[model samples]
Target: MFVLNTFDIGECLSFLCFISVSLIFCFFMLFASSVLGGKSLSRYKHTPFESGIDPVGDTSLHFSIKFYLVAMFFVIFDVESLYLYVWSVSIIETAWKGFIEAFIFILFLLLSLFYLIRIKALNWVHK
Candidate 1:
């Protein structure tokens, strides 16, 4: 025999209610849009509008490699900082093992940074 406890039944009912409400809301919005929306055939309406300023020049402009390199460095350092923050927060619980691991991680990051600097990867003027 299949049996469900009060908690299980309540959870199931809650889930079903949530799903039904979401569906109803979605359908209502779709129906309302269809009823109230206006059709437009203006030529300017289809063009991309940028704060009323007419777009000029080539859309596909070439960017310097320095820009991409700096962006990549920023992302890498940002993620490293996030890892360091998490490790710092749980330092007391993790103790020496965490400290050693964090040290190694930071060491590798420092080495990579030094290597990039030595190779002039961050030099914008040289390019």
Candidate 2:
């Protein structure tokens, strides 16, 4: 039961046109590359090359648990920062209630960080 107005229809048409043009450009570039790019069947072409030197040993490296823990912490904090940014931007609309909610959110983040520190979860080396 939703109806779109003339302005909405115009916007939809423009969006469709933009998508069509983008797809056409992408396909054209792909086709041109396949046609114009060099085709090599040389033995060294498939080998992994790094810093102008031939790659030796396994390319895959095993990472420590600390690396993953730090990465997870970074991602968690990054997402929390995004939420805080949005809340800060819409402060006027949110007013006092939003301020309280954001305060609580920040408090929880600090508590969690402290908990991680107490548990030695953020420590780089195992004892």
Candidate 3:
């Protein structure tokens, strides 16, 4: 049988204790809310409010594809920035090879951006 070291056993106990405390707290909150919360149902409270503006027009308006393209570009660049951040954090360990790799990565990003600009993918108003 594999025996856990004291530190490992302590960690396990602490984790279990944390889980138990969380469960107890969650159960207590649920019970208290059920017993003490009000049950008021008003028409004004039921209607959805948007920045204090009442529902005015049709909710299902068609969105421009450019909006979706912008969102996708934002996500792609955001993830690339994350990779750059991690690479920057470990720059010293990665040295010249990492520098070359990051340069290539950035080159690709710039090329993609230029392509998008050339295709007018970033343009809000279509010609």
Q: Which candidate number maximizes TM-score? A: 2
- Which 10 consecutive positions of candidate 3 have the poorest summed lDDT? 1-10
Clashing pairs in 3: none
What ranges in model 1 sit over 4 Å off? 1-36
In model 3, the runs with Cα more than 4 Å from the true position are 1-9, 12-35, 50-55, 59-61, 125-127
lDDT of 3: 0.92
Compose the digit string of candidate 2's lDDT tens values, residues 7-118.
6678789999999999999999999999999998998988877889877788899989898999999999899999999999999989999999999999999999999999
Report the Cα RMSD per candidate: 6.3, 3.8, 5.4
Q: What's each prediction's TM-score?
A: 0.68, 0.77, 0.61
RMSD of 3: 5.4
Give the alpha carbon lDDT tens digit for every residue of 53-94 in model 1. Answer: 998877788999889999999999899999999999999998
Superposed by TM-score, candidate 1 places the C-alpha of residue 35 at a distance from the truth, in angstroms, of 7.1
Which pairs, if any, clash in model 1? Answer: none
